[model samples]
Target: MFELNDLRQTRFYQDVFAEGKQKGRQEGKLETIPQLLALGLSIQQIAQALGLDEQLVKQAAQPKS
Candidate 1:
């Protein structure tokens, strides 16, 4: 039977874990865009600081429509 430790050692599990971490980090960065904007940072500055694309930052800045 597969144990919890065995599952963690599998390639698929590792890949999924890594992907989740990356996605979480990206979401966190995108969520921060508004607060940074409130603090007077430009889209370019936010993109440079967050290591994200200017387009992504701009999209994040857009109103929900």
Candidate 2:
């Protein structure tokens, strides 16, 4: 029987887990932009610190439409 534990042991599962982890980390960084801005950090500074593109930082700072 292919149990949850068995599924978790597969290469595909591992790859997906890694991808999700990276995405989560990226989202966490994006989420922090507001706080950083409130702390008086410029968009350029945030982009450099987070290793993100300046355009991405600018997009994150904008209010969601």
CA RMSD (A), model 1: 0.7
Among all windows of 10 consecutive residues in model 2, the one with the lowest summed lDDT is: 56-65
Error of 1 at 46 (Å): 0.2
The list of candidate 2 runs beyond 4 A from truth reads none
Each prediction's TM-score versus the true structure = 0.95, 0.87
Give the alpha carbon lDDT tens digit for every residue of 1-65 in model 1: 98999999999999999999999999999999999999999999999999999999999999778
lDDT of each: 0.98, 0.97
